[model samples]
Target: MLIGAVVLVLGSLFLVVPFLLGNTGVTGFVIGFIASLIPLTVVLLTVRLIDRWEPEPKRLLWFAFTWGAAVSIAGTLLIQPLFALAAPTSSEEAFTYFMATVQAPIVEEFTKSLGLLVLILAARKYFDGPVDGVVFAFTIAAGFAFTENILYFGREIASSNDPGTDLVRIFILRGVMSPFAHAVFTGTTGLIMGFAARKWHSGYAVLAFFIGLLPAMFLHNRWNSMGQNFLVEYFVVQVPIFLVAAVGIILLRVAEGKLTRQRLLEYARAGWFTPAEVEMLATSRGRRQAIRWASSRGRGRAMKSFIKGATALAFTRQRILSGRDVHVHQHDELELLRKIPTLRAAVLQ
Candidate 1:
């Protein structure tokens, strides 16, 4: 937590410096910053819905967002300029196109992905599966997009003769139309790392990160390359792809819920949880009903804790069954098992 706090502070410095030094006036900056929040809120609510089955730790989620908004953006700002210093002189238009299509995708996706790598390394236990990966990826990407949108919006507002018109146009294009652009790119990496977390060692998980980058970079490249035909291509190509990805994510979420139930059932057989308790813990409706019951008895908070612990316990059992890092998961399994009864007692009290 201390390390995360320090990183966030340093990243905040990186984030603020550009805005402070930019040509955008205070008014433009403030407007852009406020506008950026609209999309950020939308993206976060969507992530929350997807993560409803088993939420990642709040601290880790915050770290991921900070890493994207601050650290990843900082890295991109620092590194992309070096390419200009090294490149041969070219027409300004040509250079801009090259930077957008080639340089930006590679640098931004890679920097964004570093946050996932950090999570896999530092908080392996929570890095459970593809849904978790998508959640973290979307969060980090949302942060990056929020910062990027501010830059774009502020610059447009500052430079344009018609600030109001341009602001609305840009907001409609970016905030309304393509808010998930960054999330989709980085989510590819997160999804792969999530699969790696299930069965692979840390070394393999790292490799999976690189492997995932291929598709992420590809999609970003294609998106950037579509300059003139963006609207048509967006509707024809990107929309379909987004729909397919959404369907896949839905299936993965369903699978995760089923996996939770399956693992908890093992515990039920061993007398850790009653069959009814497993039913209550595994299903969304069951959980809501349980919480309502507990709330009536003034133990809503305790019920939530019990449900959370049981969910974590189910995943820990999954890690044990997978036969990778057994010792580590064994410790987690025992700890979760020990705490669960207490949580249940609290819920019932």
Candidate 2:
């Protein structure tokens, strides 16, 4: 409740204030939306696909994105300037470097990450493992990037003598090459939080956050500190980091697959699931087959929902077995249970 209220207030302020100030004209607004929409759509779809086996709630995903685009950006706007005022600088270039390398990494990463941490504190059940963490992290980063793109696109087009060429160039640089940069950084933190959520007690979640956050900040610093050759920085640093993040994501996916099978087996032992259902839940190919079978009877959505809810239920039960949460777990279990019967009947029919 508190988290939702905070996000609602901050997001409204950030979204409305610029418009009231006449900072963004329609042309700049249109350009920004077009510039961000393509990449945002692509990234969102990709992340959703990765999480297809066990989808997080759509509402929470939107909340993460909203928090990032509106709340986090607003908070960064207020906080970074304070650090600039406090620091001594030799030249504009030096100060620019200071803001980019030091202030940005600290402020932006924390701002982007705070949403996930809050969700972890407020609604830990959404996260079954690293994939959930990574998905939320990527969604929030995508939101931040979208809003930042809007502001940058608006400002650049408004200021430039040749808006056409400059806008295209900026779009190519930020939209194409660097779309996933923010996601990868904050995702590092999210991955650790997911691990803490899965394995360790709630008490360790904070320590896990720092462990993830430090790397995110360091990487953000490295990228920001690099000199003016965008291509050089991208190839030398950005690409490598992206590759590492990709490998990490793949590993997490594999881990989720294993965890799913293990959790389903526990359910099987409790007589809640069958071996066939366990196998279907465990493998991507089997899941596709199950979907196809359900679709033949016009119940694909129900089957999908059943699979997703069952996955969440399994993870929640796993967390309970580990001796952690109770009330949230019980609440989530009941909610999932209530919605799943119709789906189960559809699939069975």
Candidate that would win on lDDT: 1
In candidate 2, what are the lDDT values of residues 1-349, reduced to their tens digit? Answer: 7566565757666654585235547777777777789778878987988888678888888788888888888788778889899565888877887888889999999888988887787777677567888999999999988888887777667778998898888888788888888888899898888878876555677777778899999988987777768778789878998998898888878777777789878878877778998888677777899999989988888888778877777777677776667776778777765765676777887
- Candidate 1: stretches off by over 4 Å: 1-12, 85-90, 288-302, 346-349
Candidate 2: residue 178 Cα off by (Å): 1.3
All models, RMSD in angstroms? 2.5, 2.7
lDDT of each: 0.86, 0.80
User: Model 2: runs farther than 4 Å from truth?
Assistant: 2-16, 19-24, 199-202, 327-342
Scored by Cα lDDT, where does model 1 land?
0.86
lDDT over C-alpha atoms for residue 207 of model 1: 97
lDDT, candidate 2, at 236: 82
How accurate locally is residue 9 in candidate 1, as Cα lDDT from 0 to 100?
51
